[model samples]
Target: MNLSRPLLLASNSPRRKELLASLGLTFEVRVKEVSEDFPDTLKREEVAEFLASHKADAYKEDLQEEALITADTIVCLDDKILNKPASAEEAYAMLRALSGQTHEVITGVCVLMKEGKTVFHDSTTVYFKELTDAEINYYIQHYKPFDKAGAYGIQEWIGMIGIEKIEGTYFNVVGLPVQKLYENLVQLKIVV
Candidate 1:
């Protein structure tokens, strides 16, 4: 596909930008603050996907003839959704809650086409080994993963030393599901 249309990424996440760059696709970043709130009635995955689609809708007017990509990721453990922490204390609390447990990292992506077509969402499971107070404290103090969901980055020291296993895409835990995004892009003929 030799498309000349530009691609727009509607997010301020550096990780998502870097992940998309890895695909060698030319794109421009357009960050718009959208409410991340979702109805409490929605389940875990539905909540995530709903937010993602809502983000995409915020950029609809700016889409032009290009495809716009928007996404939302959440960490779920025992039906609880863990988003980015509001403070250092919250971050610490989230990490402590995740210690020695398996969690689901669900990423909802909305790829909006120029012709009004769209596709979205993917989920990955990650497991963390039991972490001591020292381990969690050290990681919180050092990494300070305030911008990441679940208060941790899978590519950081915590994941290196604390994650025991993962059942799905590693990139999904990082932020975006590149493989799934690529497949959808291909189907949309957005990239060769």
Candidate 2:
């Protein structure tokens, strides 16, 4: 499919870039520093969507005529949001909370066309088997998942041995929900 305008991904996440590439779409990356702060009163899913849109808004002036994509993923467990871990101890704690439990991974995506706008979100429920302290410690020390949400990556060692099941898109847990984003792009007339 030949598109009139090029595609721009306004994110620095390698996972999102890989996911987008899997769809066979050629794109360019432009990273911008945007504040992710949101109102604490916003609900979990709302927070994700808001932040994703906020990132997209940062590139409005630089969008030109190309379609821009921005997204944010959050791990929510028991009403708390688990983002990137600040320290090894935090990573261990986040993993412990997810062990032998089901948590929701919601990814909010914003697809901004030159003249059209579309925003949507996808969520996946991940279930982790009980994790021993040794397993958690080993993964933390070996992998250092400080850049991943919930202190883990679905495509990493911890996920291979810890996640027992998932009720939604597996890619969403990694970062971006490609299937959902593709559909939304078509709906917004960004791609056909």
Candidate 3:
């Protein structure tokens, strides 16, 4: 849990917090309200990183000596972004769209310090088996994945049953790409 500097995770996501803690570095949870909007001109692959950096900037003025970590996760299918669902019907539709389809889960991360900043992203391609309407409803009713991107949590029951395979790290699909983030923190001498 020793770190070169105080670490601040600028996210309210429980999954990200858990992932960061799994790295064995103690960090403080610091949440700030920031706009998640991105330009329409940005490609699907670029939005996650863009929003991550944007969130990082919002916390820059508050940075003293602490290293701030910010991240944004998005689910993309056929060049469309599936944001957090607002209603059960929307969640159902998203899960339906993802049934038997391959989709990209991209997480953009930013490590910011008063000295400098590093912005990067990790992409994982997730393959879902065809899900039955009953299965989808069951998951929605039981898990209530409205807070997750793509209306699904890879660590949840639906993921256990629906996910067939993934090309990249499973942790990336969970939320934070801890391997990459740990490396970045080490390279920056933020963590021992």
lDDT per residue (tens digit) for residues 64-97 in model 3: 9999999999999988999999999999999999
Off by over 4 Å in 3: none
lDDT of 3 at 82: 98
User: Which ranking of candidates, highest lDDT first?
Assistant: 3, 2, 1
lDDT by residue (tens digit), candidate 2, 67-96:
988999999998999989999999999999
lDDT of 1 by residue, 1-192 (tens): 344578889989889999998888889898888999999999888987899899888877766788888999999998999989988899989999999899999999888865775656788889899999999889989998999999999999999999999999999999899999998888887886
Best by lDDT: 3
By summed lDDT, the worst window of 10 consecutive residues in model 2 runs over: 183-192
User: Best candidate per TM-score, number?
Assistant: 3
Can you list the residue pairs that collide in candidate 3?
none
Better of 2 and 3 by TM-score: 3
Report the Cα lDDT for residue 107, model 2. Answer: 94
The lowest-lDDT stretch of 10 consecutive residues in candidate 1 is: 113-122
- lDDT values, one for every candidate: 0.89, 0.89, 0.94
